[model samples]
Target: MKRVLLHSAFWLVYLLQDTVLEFVWVGPALKNIPEDVQFWMAFKAAIAAVLPKLLFTYFILYVVIKEIIKGNVRLSWIILQVMAAFIIIIILHRIVFVYYINPVIYGGVLKERPLFHVLSVLLAVMDIGFVSGVAITMKLLRIQLVAREREKNLIKEKLGAELKFLRHQTNPHFLFNTLNNIYALARKQSEHTAEVVMRLSKLLRFILYESKSNLITIEDELRILDDYIALEKIRYDRLTIHFQREIDESSGKIAPLLLLPLVENAFKHGASESRFDSFIRIHVQLQQGRLTFNIENTKENHTAEEIRDNIGLGNVRRQLELMYKEYDLQLQNEPHLFSVRLYINLTSYAQV
Candidate 1:
């Protein structure tokens, strides 16, 4: 609002100055001429006097001033000479129009006297004052635009760095959990421990390489989830783990490493340490430019004490807030089950 008011005030002042000058100087000078002819003549004179100086002022403000402070050779001399030449041109233009043109048409008493030199001096001073004011205004506007652009870029850079840091934190957290699970398997001397290690190696490789990108195909993220589930199933092969996906293969792009946090949270809080015929049902579907994910797990009857904290889920919530500020998120925990439901708009990018 302040900026709008300031700009409005500037334009008001500028137009008022030009209109007043046109009314005062040219309007009276063309008084004896026909109304239509006087209008055209005054308009032409105003253009001839103002256009060149206005163009020159803007060039000096935007181009010369921009380059002059860079310490170029003879810049000061060049600028001084340019200003002197511009003033001379403006003064000459005003003198010719006021003396010869206005006298021939308007037929005023001052036409007999040597009035061109006096009028030229006064008009030249006015031109210089107007040009100086215009230059300062242009300089201030350019500075404001540059400052705004710099601020926007700074914000973008900060968000990029923070998202990268969050991804880094998530990778280590995932590694710690995987290594701990592997250690437990080794302690038990499970026959399928080597297979779990191999699958984990592939998953780690995907995370290290693919997760470095700002964006990746949804298929790649799905493959990472598949690798993680394979590792999980090695430990829970006897229980049911139903994973379903109904995604459009043609639209496959998504933000890299975005979905894993949610999936990891579900597994961390839902799958591990559950008893009494445990089961996890995962559904992922993309429809009408939106992606929906639902994860539900049947909880143990009396093991509520084992799953109280929402560490991974809290991280997922914060990440969602950062990534999809406009999306919907709902998580519910009941006596028999824990579930998460999310619907994210993907129209800004390609959807899958």
Candidate 2:
């Protein structure tokens, strides 16, 4: 329906344009005729001349252009088709003008002209060529626009699939570590085992449900971080952890579960592996739509082989890259300390 309307509008404008041009060309010659009569004669001539032009334009647009775009017809065959159609359309337009238009507009006083006069055929060619060029240009532009839109959609879908796969990778890694914590408590027969299980369930529920969305409120994310920290704290008696938050609640939302993996990495490689007293420091600050998160943890002094990229940090990095265009992730690895700092322009994500 939209295409039909577009074609109709195109032809309507063409007809009006042809009428105005016809009136301008013939007005000075018909000085005795009234202005309204001269305009009526020009309009009627345009209407009569349009039939051949319309046929010629549609033939080239639908038939010749379609075959050329399909790439099935040989170049020689396409040239032959166009040349034959042009000759026939030119003759048809001349017959319409000489027999139909001239007789009516000149009151049958004008002498009969040959069907294939050189000037008339040349004028027909110019008329047909101009309109066909415009039509073909419009057609090619529409095709290019559609192609670009399709390519854009395909890229978006590919990225969405990759993100989902990354999330799948991340979810099991988190579950594995949390279940290990629970397993240790269960084996120890610790009194906090039941409470730990409850917290784990809540965390699991959030992961299974809330984390499905592309973004969630910053407050929701912080709440999940607090829950995970509390659950992990139950496993160790001497672990020192400090989480400081300075958040603007109305700032913006973030990708769900994007930060949990950083905290998980700290607990997995730093505090959990150290034999002596260990500490983890976390600070999350969001002000005026900018978010800065920093996490640091103490680890035992060991060889370089002991420190390596784990799944959690890698997952967080990948998510940040896919989700935010304006963001930074930095890692600082010392002999006894591992630190991560991330900065994100939440307003940019909002714009996206």
Candidate 3:
């Protein structure tokens, strides 16, 4: 639509220049001719006037513009070539107008005058300059537009790479703690030890393979979360915790590893640290291309001098900024509880 409008506007300018402006500027000189003859002569002159300019403009387009853009020709050489071409074009245009068009239109060899010839050639050169100006402007505009599009694509690719990097950067501290849990279980020889190891294997596999992609099904993410929760439960076996999933259209897709950091934080600061009467609650709702993930957990209080390291939440927030242009994340730290609520618009991804 924009191209159509631009072309329409260009041709309208050309039409006005040829039909109206040409006659007004050059008509009074041909007053000796009949009115109809004057109009015909003016029309023929206008056509002949623009023909050489078109040829020169096309030469600039096909050869000069290409060479200049590619840096294959020096600026000084280009200017020299244009000047030499302009001289030849003006001379040929004057010759053609005097020998062919005027004799045929006037029915005789008109005055062989130098001043008139020089003036006409000057006018023709001005028209050629006009054509050159328009051609250069349009060519530069197209080049700029192409450059802008390439820049936009490059930015998208960079953002995508950053988001993937952040996802792949799973907390090393979490892994370190889980290994200690497995070591403790081995010493105890509990039946649940094998189950915990299997869960850990599954969690590692999911992180290494399934979460490699930028997008995955909500169901897949939930399963990853379940494995993680099970591992945490084994690590802190005596905590009273709740994980609730209220899912509709669980097949909805989202960026992988987005919600896991919040859950990890909940366990790190809430359920694992509390002495007694502690609880962690997680709720996930997926329906109609929208996701609401909420986690609230009982937290122990500390003064400003004592604060848990918050690098995990900071890193996840950065990843979310890269993945989503419009999303909702609320982190609330009340006196007794730490809560995180995340909302996402998933209309673009229906399945994994």
Candidate 4:
């Protein structure tokens, strides 16, 4: 409200000042009038001086301010007409006051003042140049705004594509691991073989339906993770896996299938190769508006070749760069343990 009032007041003061100048400064050359009617002539002179300036100021204010507020002004004809019309009006009003009205009131004939030949033409030319410059500036600002919007949309599209590709890669890697477990059970003719197949089907269904979105509720992601852990549990009944969670329900949404690759990497390096007292630990929590994921696994053999072969972990880093650019992820492969610590700025991820 204050800004709007300020805008209106600015125009009012501007128009009032210009009106005073046009009416008083370049006044008429009065002549041959009785002394008794001098007071009336002064009044006429004031109007003649102020009226033209008011009209010109009003024309400029109307055209530019209206365009700014409404986003466009459709007045090409009026803009052109104003320059000629205002000058003519000013001259005609001066002629009528000097020739007819003054004579009737002062009781003597007064001659008409000659029209301003050079001043009229100059005023018109300057007004045209000023209006043209304003129009060009408005057009340039609009073009620059559109270009910035287009650039932001392009970045959003690229991020979405990268996330989709990461999801696709994860799906196959998961399937290969599950099928291998099933193959082992089939060869032994175990009774839990049917149960493992059912679990795999449910996992596939969730990925196909829920994981397609850019973001999903935390509960949905947690459920998928639990189902994955169950499938792995069946494959290795003798191995120990300790899972601890301290997630906040208030966290709104996160990218689906984002953390599964890390879990798969842990199982690959920890459970598949370890022999005795081997364990994989996963701890998740939310604090101070940030989500933290810590995973540590006992690596029986910590080798560079094994870490390079971990395709899912590599893609996770790439996806984080493209999707959550400011995310902090740390990985350490010690002689006895391999650990991954991840922190996501929930505020930043929420924007995507």
- Ten residues in sequence with the least summed lDDT for candidate 1: 302-311
The superposed Cα distance between candidate 3 and the true structure at residue 278, in angstroms, equals: 2.5
Q: Candidate 1, TM-score vs. the true structure?
A: 0.65
- Score candidate 4 by TM-score against the native: 0.64
* Candidate 4 lDDT for residue 335: 84
Q: Is candidate 2 or candidate 3 better by TM-score?
A: 2
Which numbered prediction scores highest in TM-score against the true structure? 2
The digit string of per-residue lDDT tens for model 4 on 149-186 reads 89888887877776787789889998998899899999
lDDT of 4 at 237: 58
TM agreement with the true structure for every prediction: 0.65, 0.92, 0.73, 0.64
| Clash pairs for candidate 3 | none
Model 3 misplacement above 4 A: 1-55, 58-88, 99-122, 171-177, 187-190, 275-277, 304-309, 348-352
Judging by lDDT against the true structure, name the best candidate. 2
Better of 2 and 4 by TM-score: 2
lDDT of 1 by residue, 1-352 (tens): 9866864676456655664565566666555666666556555445555555555665666566666656674867876867776776665656555665556544442344354577666666677567557757777777889989999888777777777777778888888888888888899999889998998889888888878776677788888888888887777644688899998763566677777777776666666757546788889998765788898887655343433435466566655666664577777777778777878776554211
lDDT of candidates 1 onward, in order:
0.69, 0.86, 0.75, 0.69
Tens-digit lDDT string for candidate 3 (1-352): 9976975677456655774665665457666767776667666666666667667776787788889889978899999988888887887777667776667654543554552466666777777787668866897889899999999889878877766666656546557667877897889887788898888888777777888776889999888888888887876755777888888887778888778888888888887678776788988988777788899988777422433437678767787667666668887777787888888886643221
